[model samples]
Target: MAVLEGDCEDSVSDSAKSCQTQSCTNCGGDGSCNMNSVCNNGCLPGFYSLACAQSCGKCGGNGSCNRLSRFCDESSCLPRYFGPLCIQLCPLNCGGDGSCDFQTANCLQGCKSRFSGTRCELSVACPSSTCRDPCQSINGGICTSGCRSGYFGEICNRVCNCQNNGACVQDTGVCESISQTTSVTVPTKFSDGKTAYQRAPAEGDPNNYGS
Candidate 1:
């Protein structure tokens, strides 16, 4: 009476355990053992259902699907692909392997000769600005979470100020805007939104704008 899943007594033989891949015969594929040793890990990619007899829609990059409920991987699709699990392909002349926008599937590299559209089929979406935050750098004037690697700023709009691949502080903005040889103007407006021209009341200096 094996009742605690994989905690089966070593006395039980492989034949009695189900499959060699450690897959459950009850699950028809990879699965964990239940109290009765019934597996439930689900089936291989592109398969579904208890018997694992169903086929899934075309997924991105031929990725896998939820074998148990048929849920699809929305982000796994390769370039030129879109829709749920990337089941759909971009237009024929969408240009550049259909590496279109993820949201609209519009090409980002522009259209081919004699073919034209407002977006040129070449497109892209606001990619993640930071791994920990969503990207809306264009729409949002300021970064809510922070900047991505190799970048730092309030809105994540400014490029890495350091040369030779140096890093900068987030709120400090202390890094050089460019390499030593390059001539570039630095931006003002400190972290507190005050400039060198503006006198601080705390410093006993006369305020320029208002009290």
Candidate 2:
């Protein structure tokens, strides 16, 4: 009877030791063991998993992850980075001097003059500095005041080449005589600067032979 009782006490001790070992194993090193012997307290910030072994991937090293889902938390991207995982770079790097949209990665401000487009990659051509007026086109090829003197054409790209001291037409750019001639007569002037003239008879003059 004494031997049977001792065997029963030993069996109880062995069973208790096994339960303790199992409970300790259930604690995943990240959390303490609960009353039910389950690893349930969750991992520390920026880490997640049953063992707290996984890091928040591409979170710019400054973001936290959801303990249960292991996904990056909202608005956790570092400066110049965006997207849910903080993997995408900000647009144009904020045009190198601007701010970026945290969600869309678009430029917020500080874009250079004549720079446009979503990323500020497209540029508007400036007018020619030599031109006296604004350019009709952004290419600086066509002038609003037309070309300067001695130049002509749609964009004043052509040079005046008229001969015989003629002036060019504004619209057609054609050369023509500067002055016109008439047939009317006037009194003649002598070398001494005296005026001389001869009067012609009218049809109704009294000395006319036909009358």
Candidate 3:
């Protein structure tokens, strides 16, 4: 009888041990069947899994991440929205973060100044209405704002400082007139009985033979 009782106790002990092992394996050795451990706590709403690695659609406003389940709750603003479930307006432009003047989109400021064109895209302007020629000898030699060069005369044709006896050649420096010539004329006559012939003064002669 004593041996049978001892065997029965031993059998009961083995069964309890087996039950504990089964429970531990089912509960990950924590000894308690915690709902958090068994239930998919990490998964987002409408999602359930051992790993909780699934999407649950966009949370309406800012969502909160569950600490234990890592689930997103659509009860507030998102990170970029930065409010109670993402209900507030973004500080910068929601799309591009460009300048948002009075809630209306306009040209944003750019790196350069004095440019108001698209996307703040424009080059610097000339000082006046016109840009100067790159080849002028003197700075600002070419006139701007419709004031033209060569205005002193035709194509800048005004007389240069070169004066008296000096002639302005085309594109050449001034040149001066040099020598002058004078001439004298004398007359002589000869009668050939039929007519009288007169010879104009020969070069170096006061008169020819006066027959």
lDDT to native, each model: 0.50, 0.48, 0.30
Provide the lDDT at 169 for model 2: 46
Candidate 3 stretches greater than 4 Å from native: 1-39, 45-64, 67-80, 92-211
lDDT of 2 by residue, 132-166 (tens): 45444322234556545444555555555454323
Question: Over all chains combined, what TM-score does candidate 1 have?
Answer: 0.34
The collision pairs in model 1 are: 31-41, 60-77, 80-98, 106-121, 107-121, 107-122, 107-123, 108-122, 108-123
The better-scoring model by lDDT among 1 and 3 is 1
Supply the global lDDT for candidate 3.
0.30
Candidate 3 or 2, higher TM-score: 2
- Which residue ranges in model 1 land beyond 4 Å of their true spot? 1-39, 118-211
- Work out the TM-score per prediction: 0.34, 0.35, 0.16
Number of the predicted model whose lDDT against the real structure is largest: 1
Q: Could you tally the backbone clashes for each prediction?
A: 9, 0, 14
How much RMSD separates candidate 2 from the native structure?
A: 19.8
* Cα lDDT, model 2, residue 129: 46
Worst 10 residues of 1 by lDDT: 178-187
Q: Number of the top candidate by TM-score?
A: 2
Return the candidate ranking by lDDT, descending: 1, 2, 3
Residue 206 of model 2: what lDDT? 38
RMSD (Å) per prediction:
17.7, 19.8, 26.0
Residue 62 in model 3: lDDT: 36
